[model samples]
Target: MLWPFGTTWRPMRQKIRGTVDLRWLTARSWTTKWYPQGIDLGTWRGRRTLAVSWFRQDRMRRHVASRIAFVDLERSRHLDVALAIEGDDGELVPAQIHAGGLAWFGDRLFVAATGQGIWEFDLAALRRVRGPIARRLAGSRGRGWRAVALVAVRTRVHPVALRCSYLGRVFDDAGEPLRRVLIGEYRADENGRIGEFVVPGGPDDRFERVDLYTPGIANMQGAVRWGDHHLVSQSDEQRAGVLWSGHRDSLSRDRIPLPIGCEDLALDLEARLLWSLGEHPWRRVVRGIPFAQLGFDA
Candidate 1:
């Protein structure tokens, strides 16, 4: 069993028993087009597929017309555009999904837009079925509501959804109360740069403090679940890094060093490897690090 400096995993068995070699299996580049900020690996029709959202320009005109697409993992090909938001005249509009936080649940894709709130798309229909516009609270307190981070949890009834924000609220799938996480009192430094307060997990099971990596900034770009802990990618305008934490009430955190220039992350636990999706040309890269190498026993 590989144990980190401060965290532990049960069963304590080493999943990958030998030294792991990391390599890039394939690379797909986008010409001038921008890929969405998030990616997830799942089996579709018995084949592994990489589902991704489309990126949009920051200008207002471009923001209202964006599209989302998916890539087939096994074949290393891009799938057709799965979902597109359009204006009343039927022109495609851009969704405000930030870089690296899209999620897939069951046969659906969920994305958070700056103007559209939380949008849910059905895989079969390739259309958005619902959005969480009403549930969006007013953007105040110097936080931007335009960005969102999502984690999907499976439940007996249906898949439960959890979302985080630049401000500090965690919401359920229906935009209901999961818990309000306190990120600490925000204050400006001498240079007027904002410094975030370090608050750990609260009593609520739905919310956990996640600022150890990117300290004051509240941008949690992406996350992947491995056993009981979730490895998260957090970044600001200049730097990016990774952090891990067990689900709420456990309060175990392990911060790991990620390869530089990694914009998004996905985990293949069965293979004991981690994948990184880079920006711009949108190349898919793989780094095989043994589970034990990460300081956790199998």
Candidate 2:
């Protein structure tokens, strides 16, 4: 049988690290309604922070909207942050969309709001608020409400044009910041695509480049480009996920087995760790794999 991307799976070459179990937050109807989808790491107020986006589902499992979990590694505490936008009356209202993926750039978190566009939230502007929206996924009864991260900006992409599934950052040759974010789709078709765009840049300078994988990987959940090689995660609900490494030519590529429901990728070049998360119901975690094991000398 032919695989869609004509890709081959290689034996696992690396062991995962920094596993943070997310199953402990199963109180109320939270886990039953929302499932994890994306993960990224960054510094918040001088503390190392990990953020995971969760898309909410109704009783029938239909996508309802999304929220974000801000994890403080040192404290081993996770705070549910509600995603919201400013309404016409200047009131903060829920930004209803599947927050498929998240990429942390400085204090801004780029969220892949599938079919809507990339939504940017400022970490410095996080505010504590009380309401039904905030308490919906609080995980604890002590807190009547949760925190809210307002949308600072939204670079809209026509639904048909690009339904972003995941986001990654691009660095210069010296690994210096490029101020650009990589956006990718989750289409299972032959023409699945990914693109690089400038963050907080000019209107005409949005899209830097777009690439379509001819024999595209089905259910591509996350993707990131480092130097000449591209690392991507593809998921199949029935089996374990796969992390594929390839180049622009698509001539030589290899894959390693990932946990079932692996959803997004975030690179910590300084620590030489590649972070991702499992999205399966009741069995979810945020973990990292070292760069050396992934064949990255940098």
Candidate 3:
């Protein structure tokens, strides 16, 4: 799929149909320390939900640890949950990775852990806790006011350990049984790569049938498919982003303007909205853009 050359590319403001703030800045001190990376929409415990992954920024502003924010759409309430892994002695320890992207499937939540591969967390294991008590007992410090933590039950390591900067699930009309997750790598000066990996059915099974492709666009933060076109987002840190719409195999495309700090992408067809989140602090928001506004036919 390619956007023909000479096609007029116009600049238009994207209309936001809905949005929810992270609510950590004014609520706690550790607010700005954590930056958003990925987002996904799904159901948990019979409730419609949205989840966003965040990484803790250290003194040098590098990502060191991560957590997830779960939003209950019905109640308009949100809960912060730290991602953890079990220690040698059955103790829970923080999962140290930049939880860059999130894809929720069934009762499992898949998190992109940069060079560490993908971490599969159990949604059913999500539990509430007091901040003060959890910090002492579970060594869960620096979480600010988060009331929940979810431990990783398994991690499927990618063969090449590609920089898993963002992720999105594949929607195939062929209806094949294989479930695939789309992995994205971010590059500053060069074009980024995207890969498709088949999700294993069981804990013992490994991710197979890995297929990689290049979208021929640099600085791509996230991507989602609509019909035959790929809606790719390219950003330069805090500057406004460009939304590229074109064929998956063609380098030519039309660029649409987006707000600054755009990170990951998720498409909700039922609601006809494209979900995206901001990365920088103070301006962070989980917002939805309608399909019509993205130049897609309704």
Best candidate (score: lDDT): 3
**For model 2, what is the alpha-carbon lDDT of residue 41?**
76
Candidate 2 vs 3: which has more TM-score = 3
- Candidate 2 lDDT by residue in tens digits, 118-178: 7777666665545554443332234443432222323233232477877876666566656
Report the number of the highest-TM-score candidate: 3
What digit string (tens of lDDT, one per residue) describes model 1 on residues 122-174? 55443322133211211112334343212221111111122222122233333
**What is the lDDT, from 0 to 100, of the residue 296 in candidate 2?**
79
- The stretch of ten residues in a row with the least summed lDDT in candidate 1 is 151-160
Q: Cα lDDT of all candidates, in order? A: 0.37, 0.65, 0.66
Query: What TM-score do all the candidates reach, one by one?
Result: 0.50, 0.78, 0.80
lDDT of 3 by residue, 102-176 (tens): 888877888888777777887666544446534522333556555333333444454435677888866654322
State, as a TM-score between 0 and 1, how close model 1 is to the true structure: 0.50
lDDT of 3: 0.66
